[model samples]
Structures are given as structure tokens and as C-alpha cells.
Target: MPLGDEPVSFTTMVRGREIRYDRDAINAYLGRLFTLPHGEELCAFQKQLSRGNWDIPLMTRTLLRRNGGFEYSAAQNPLRVLRDEMATFTQLLLLLVLHNIQPCSHT
Candidate 1:
């Protein structure tokens, strides 16, 4: 697979269930997502996740569509890029927690 060149249609088996997704629709949705403001997109996604109204394919589409509130990188592995963003967020969260618990003193 190459950047911006996903299969138009694909199928796979998951947990004994067959799944199919149209990459065209995913791409269209991604295009629309990118048009929205950064905060708006994330708020919408968070709301959806809280409602537990998402599936693997839907999540996949959303993750692939996201670019961490920055310009789309056109990376070969969008998922990996998303994972890296998640790691950064996790680290930031840890730092926040530690800061709150143990404030740093000025040198």
C-alpha cells in the first residue's frame, strides 16, 4: 500500500465475522473531517467514543483520517502516525499528573 492509494474495496475476517469496507467512502469522510476545525473534530470524536457507538472499521476510518491537529502527513502508515500521537499524549498526561503531584521548584 502507498500513501493516498488504498484499495477502493477490501474485505477481511474478524472474529469469525466477515467485514467489508469501501475505501472510497472512507476517503470521502476523511476529506470532510479534515475540513473541520481541529477542536471541533476532536470534540466530535470524543463524544462518539463516549457514546460507545463506534466499530473497528469506523474507528479505522477516523484514525486514518486524523493528522493530530496538523497538516495531513501523507504517511504510508497513518495508523502508526496516530499511535505516535497517542504516545505523545500519554506522555503529556503523565507529566501533567506528576506536575500536579510534585510541583517543580525554580532553580
Candidate 2:
């Protein structure tokens, strides 16, 4: 569960499903967020949200990935995470986001 650690394996009960988890995709996202002028924008946006003020325009822009893919929620529960039909990219992103937002586990 450490940062940058990849899942050891994935299992599913169904067949004929496509699941892709490209580590490069995640690294690319982080790289862009850290290296570009957009980082300031991101920080400012997060600050605005933290202040309880909603920015509809910024929310719309934040939902799209750099590759032009739209962001969507993926189930994080172990049972649903094991499903073969889920989009791997969204699942990974959700995991990363949740990790950032959630408190550290004591166990």
C-alpha cells in the first residue's frame, strides 16, 4: 500500500473484460502536476474548495484528464475493485485521490 507500489495481482470471476493499469499514466499525471504552471492553478483551486466556495468552472476543468479522458468514480471496495469490467485508470486515480484525502491507517 506504499506510494508507487503496484498491485501484486488482480483477479476476477468474469471473462471478456479489458482492464489496463499503466504505471506510466500515473507518473505522467504527477509529473505534469508538479512540473507545469498548472500546479499553481491546482493549489489555488484546492484552496478555493477548502474555503467552502464552489467554483463550477474550475470543477469542470478538473474533471478532464490531460489525455482528454473524463474522470469518473470507480468502486473502491475490495469486492468491486476485483471486478474485471471496471476502468483501471479511473480505479487507480480514485485510489490515489482517496489515499491523499483519507487519514493514515493505524494498523
| Best candidate, lDDT | 1
Residue-level lDDT of model 1, residues 1-107, one tens digit each, is: 23596744465669998676555556675675334575464567788867755464454444443444223346722223333543455556657877886678764
Runs of candidate 1 with Cα error greater than 4 angstroms are 1-9, 24-107
Q: Write the per-residue lDDT of candidate 2 for residues 1-107, one digit (tens) a residue.
A: 33477755433335776443355545565675334374363566687757756543453345433334323457521222232333556557777877876748865
Prediction 1 TM-score vs. true: 0.17
How high is each candidate's TM-score? 0.17, 0.23
For model 1, what is the error of residue 98's alpha carbon versus the real structure, in angstroms, after optimal superposition? 28
Question: Model 2 compared with the native: what TM-score?
Answer: 0.23
lDDT of 2 at 5: 78
What C-alpha RMSD separates each model from the true structure? 17.8, 17.7
